[model samples]
Every structure is written in structure tokens, then in C-alpha cells.
Target: MRLFDKEKGLFISGPEKQISCASQIWMILAGVTDRETGINIIEALDHCPDAEGMSSPYMYHHRIQALIDLGLKDRAYREMHEYWGGMVNRGTDTFWELYNPQNPDESPYGGIVIHSFCHAWSCTPAYFLRKYYY
Candidate 1:
């Protein structure tokens, strides 16, 4: 039973499966797989936008970080704005609210939670830009 064999038995599956695969591929290309792959995962991510909806901030953050890593500060800034903008339009105040725990056994916190998240989300790019580009 080979891992990553798409035709195998039971395996993980979902709408974001493609993005997960891409992340693994990117990691491999980034030399995390071996001592000689010597590939830039960040550049690879910058070239691929199909993984934009994986529901993982770390993944999305990495994509933006990759853009920055590749010296595309302006593009990264733009992408960050677009990303948070979409989240905002969806009524989520912050990215965390989209995934944060609401109560001890439920979903998001709602209301101020959304607003707080949005504020933080909106500030991220500006913070990054000021810290790295300015």
C-alpha cells in the first residue's frame, strides 16, 4: 500500500484535497523532502492559486509569505488585501472567527468576534508591509 496512491483504499478526501496535495508537493519541492530537491516552494505557491481555499490560515499565510519570500512584496500585499477583503465581505470580522471555538462545545464566538478578527485581518498586511517593505 503506497502512500499518496490515489487509487488505493479508504483515504482522506474533500473539496480542499487538491490544495492539501499541492501543499505537500510544495513542501517536497522546497527541499523538506530531501537534501537535494533545492526547489523554492514559495515560488511554486506564487505560481499556483488553486490552493487558495484550503481553510487553513497557515496555508494561506504561507502562500502570502511565499510571495514575500520571492521578493514580490507589492503582490503579496495586494493578495493579502484581497484575501481578507473576501473574508470581510462574508461577514467574518477576523479570519479566526471563521474557525474559532464559540463556546466549550460549539462554533464561532460571533459579533465582536467577527469585528475583532476583521480588524486584525485588515491590519496584518499593513503590519507586514511596514515591517518588511518600509
Candidate 2:
């Protein structure tokens, strides 16, 4: 399985050469590398200069799981609390399909009308917290 970039110090997708948080998180989930290496890859992703960032709750969930797998439970839990709590504080009864704190109104579609406020995928923070932290 192809993994990281020796030069950029992050995971890279083949063919397109695009580096993404999803690729790195999936590699960690697959258990194909050492824990130290996985943590390094995750740290690299945290500090990566990539403009894509995390585009979906699906991707963020993976990143949180990766952090937990790497024994960064506090970091993972803190992220979960902050991320989901932010949504809760904003008056959301259910987790959103996508949430970007920097842009509260951000949407994958052309407008906010198409956004899913109660996405199933976005409900995993409770599971992560219960499984790993609580």
C-alpha cells in the first residue's frame, strides 16, 4: 500500500498526487504502519498546508478515530467536545452533515437550504466519546 511523501511529510494519493487527511486517517485505521509513524503522519496532517482541509463530517470522524488509535485520547476528546459542542451551542437539535466553525453557514451545496442538519454520519462523536473517553 502506498503511503507518505518523503519530501512533504504527509500521505499522498497516487496518480493525482493529492495529499488529503482522509488518506492518512484511513492508513492509520488499516493498521498498516507503526504507531509512531502513524502519529507522525497524523501530526503532519494537522500541520499540513493543504488548502483542502477537512470537507466533511465523515472525514472528521476518521481523523478523531485515528487520534484515539494513536493514544491521543485527550486531544481526540477535546476535538469532539469542541466540534460537536459548537454545533450544539448554535442551537442545532441534530448534528449537521457538514460544519466549519470558521464559517457557520458553510455548505457543500450551492446554498444552505440543501444542507442536512441531522446527518447520521455526524452523530458519531457520542460513540467515540462513550467508547474511548467515558
Candidate 3:
């Protein structure tokens, strides 16, 4: 309850004071939130037009897995298309540690060049493709 922001309709990192898909993912993974509430959280997040969103592919990877666990395959696919495919559409041969379609210069580390442009954290697609798609 302390972590969930009722006003925003998602879980958050208290100190950061931002709605966190990561927190919702961890809550679902750790069984802190029940199945129904997990679904509600996901739905609420979808409707939360102003939520900042997962900062990078690293955080988004867990979000994909969490969506899979919750049986939201279509939602997971759409999220992948939106995040990872956003990079693909840009002709990036490799996935990035940080990315923002609206602003390529955006970076949590203060500069775009400071992070991994081709990161290992983005390699889990094969796992999902094999286990879930195949």
C-alpha cells in the first residue's frame, strides 16, 4: 500500500516518486500483489497516459516477462513493438542500453554516448521467441 500510488494507479519507488513498471513487475514476480490486482495494475498503467514509463530496455525486459507471466501476450507484443521495434525502425543493428524515440539525445547517465548502444541486456528476445512463440 505504501508503494502503490492510488492517485496514479501504479506502484512506485517511494524515494523516486515515479510510477514504476519495475515495481509492478517485482510485485507480481514476488507474489506481493494477487493475480487480479496484477491485471488491474497492468490495465491501469495502460490507461495512465502521463506515466513516465520504463527508462530502458533493461527495465523493459522484466516488464515483458511479467506480462508473459500474467498471460498478457498481446500486450507484451505491443510493448515490444513500441519499445524494441522503435529502435528497429531506426535501423539500429543492435539494441541499446538507453533509448528514446522522441529524443535520441536523452540519457539517464547525462549523455547519450555514455551508455551501451549495443547492450547484452537486450538479448533476451531469443528466449522469448523460443519459449513463448515457438
Candidate 4:
């Protein structure tokens, strides 16, 4: 699908054509097609560089939700545990606004100190786990 750019190895939104994981997640959530197609789209994400990878908990939350909707419960729970648990392993008392284990010190504002350590968006794992996994 043109929604995804195989050359760029990422999913792009219409018009602006901006590549973001959110687009893929939303399309899957909307039931774009079969589960295999959804799985392929997500697999394509692995080809993208870490800079283009999911940088926010907001996107992660949606991605996890999509996985659950696709009947990928085991993967969803595994990813939830890995992503969120990684932060916990790092000594995070609360979820951070942005997290990239590959580059833990990455910051959009040029400094890590400005990043939000306790963000509302990052707190939705509780709801997802309760409503779906638990």
C-alpha cells in the first residue's frame, strides 16, 4: 500500500506523507485488512532507523492496543513488559514522555533534563493491561 513507503521503510500519513508509527497503528486499529497485513506493516517498522522509531509512549500505547486488537495477545504483552519494564529497570518511578532504549539520553529539546518524567500519556499501560491483558 502507498500508505507505507517500502523504500523509506516506514508508514507515511496521507498528504503530508509524514512517516510515523501512529499511522500504522491507527490503520491496523481501524481494521485496514487481514492480520497478516497488519503484521507485515509492523515488521516493516524494524527496517527504519532508531531516529524514526517510536519515540513517545503515546505511540507505544496505540501500537500495543493495535496488537491486542489483531489477536496478538502474546506479542502485545511481551512488548508491554519489555518497553515499560525497560523503564522500570532504568529506575524510572514514573513513565517518561519519550523513551528509546537504544539512546536513553535522547531529548527533543537538546537536553534530557527538559523531558517529562511523569507523563499522562505514558500512564495508559495500566488501563491497557487492565482492560485487555489482565
Candidate 5:
């Protein structure tokens, strides 16, 4: 109840004080929300119009899992291609620790020089795609 903002139809996160993505996905995975509410929350994940979508592959992995669990695999697959595909298009041989297409060179540590372009958590699609899709 507290996590959702009914008026805006998004999580209570971002500049107005919402958390990032992980908890909500966990809630869905843990069976905390009823099916419809879980679906709505997962569908409304951007948090706010001004919010940049989640940047961490760890968080994206959680979202992907929630989508898979909720039977929203097409959306999950599209999301993977759009986000991780951008990495491929950039000629990357590995996944990144963090990426935001809006700020392609962003690094949580401060600069691109410190970024982990090959973050292990970013390899989730292999496991998920194989298990769920094939």
C-alpha cells in the first residue's frame, strides 16, 4: 500500500522519494502482492516520467525474472534486446555493470574509466533465455 502511489500510478520512488527497482520485483517473486497488483506494478516500473529506468543489470535481471514469472516474456525479451542489445551494438564483448542509454557513458563510480563493462550479473540473459525460452 505504502509503496504504490495511486494518483501517479507508479512506485513511490525517484525525486519524490521512491526506491530503485529491486524490492518490487522481490515482492512479486515472494508472492507479496496479489497477481493483478503485481502485474500492474511490474508494468509500471519506470517509477516516474522523469525517472531514468533502472541501470543495473542486477535490477534488470530481477525485472526480467518477474516478467517471466508473470508470463510477460515478450516484454521481457524486448527489454533485454533493447537494453543489452545496445551494448552489443556498441561493439561490446561483455555486459556492463551499469548502463543508461540516455547517458551512454555513465558509471556509478564516477567516470567511464572506472566502469565494469563486463559485469558478471549482466550475463543473466543466457540463463533466463535458455531456461524459459528454449
Candidate 6:
């Protein structure tokens, strides 16, 4: 794989490959390389199938939010549909707790503790898109 470093940040690419859960989360927020070629974010999730299944709702929600920021409403809405559809198939209750979160009174942890690496990488586009696009 080839890695590129620019003022924006670091990016890696090549024939499809697996990245650590930490790195995958980073790339998502950082935005995939060569978006013009239509590198779908969904493709990256394949590397973390368990995370995908466990956190699909959050991931999809973030993607939709990112799409909206990119002014890709059509794509965002389509993803929303797919997300809800997947929830229907997978059973919404199975993942609802992660979204709702819980207090100590309710549970030991409050909501899912998604790593900071995941947050920074997953949300990077919303923060740096103008640098790359505008």
C-alpha cells in the first residue's frame, strides 16, 4: 500500500487491505483517500465486521451526518434507508443500548466508550473537508 502525507493529514491506500480497529476508525474520520473515485466508506467497515455489526447504527449515523455536510443529501438519505433497513433485519433492540447510554444507576458504564482514535478519525472529514474540497 502507498501512504501519503499532506498538509491535511496522513492517508494510506492500495488493493483492499485490513487495518487495525483503531486505524480503521481513524481513516473514517480522516476521510478516505481519492474520494473522487467514489471510495465508499461502507467498504472500509468490512474490515471490522464485528464492529460493523455491533456499531452499525452509530457508524451509519455518522456517515449520514458527513454526507449531509458534503451536501450529498441524496446519498445520505439512501444510507439512512439502508441503516434503518439493516436495523430492521438485525433487530433494533439488539443495538439500542449503545445509543441510549446508561447512568451508574442504570448500568456500570454510560453508553459505549468509543475510543478517541475512532472519534477523531471518523469525524475528521466534518472538521477538514474544506481543506480538501473547498
Weakest ten-residue segment in model 2 by summed lDDT: 1-10
Name the regions of candidate 5 deviating beyond 4 angstroms. Answer: 10-19, 50-52
Q: What is the lDDT of every predicted structure here? A: 0.47, 0.81, 0.79, 0.81, 0.78, 0.41
Q: What's the residue-level lDDT of 81 in candidate 2? A: 84
Candidate 4, which segments miss by more than 4 Å at Cα? 1-19, 48-51
What's the best-to-worst order under lDDT?
A: 2, 4, 3, 5, 1, 6
Question: Which candidate should be chosen as best, given lDDT against the real structure?
Answer: 2
Superior candidate under TM-score, 1 versus 6: 1
- TM-scores for candidates 1 onward, in order: 0.44, 0.88, 0.82, 0.82, 0.83, 0.36
Worst 10 residues of 1 by lDDT: 3-12
Cα deviation of 121, candidate 4, in Å: 0.5
lDDT of 4: 0.81
Task: Spell out the clash pairs found in candidate 3.
Answer: none
The C-alpha RMSD of each candidate to the native structure, in angstroms, is: 8.3, 1.8, 2.4, 2.8, 2.6, 10.5
Pairwise TM-score winner, candidates 5 and 6: 5
Model 1 has an lDDT value of: 0.47
Task: Tell me how far candidate 4 lies from the true structure as C-alpha RMSD in angstroms.
Answer: 2.8
Tens digits of lDDT, candidate 1, 17-124: 444434544454353433222133334434555633344344556556655655667877777777666666667555643322222122334444333343343355
lDDT of 2: 0.81
lDDT, residue 108, model 2: 65
Model 6: CA > 4 A from native: 1-10, 13-54, 89-134
Please give the range of 10 consecutive residues that has the lowest summed lDDT in model 4: 44-53
lDDT computed for candidate 5: 0.78
- Top candidate, metric TM-score: 2
* lDDT tens digits by residue: candidate 4, 1-134: 76667676556875977766777777888887578878887777656554246778888899898888788889989998889898999998899999987788888899889999999999867998789867
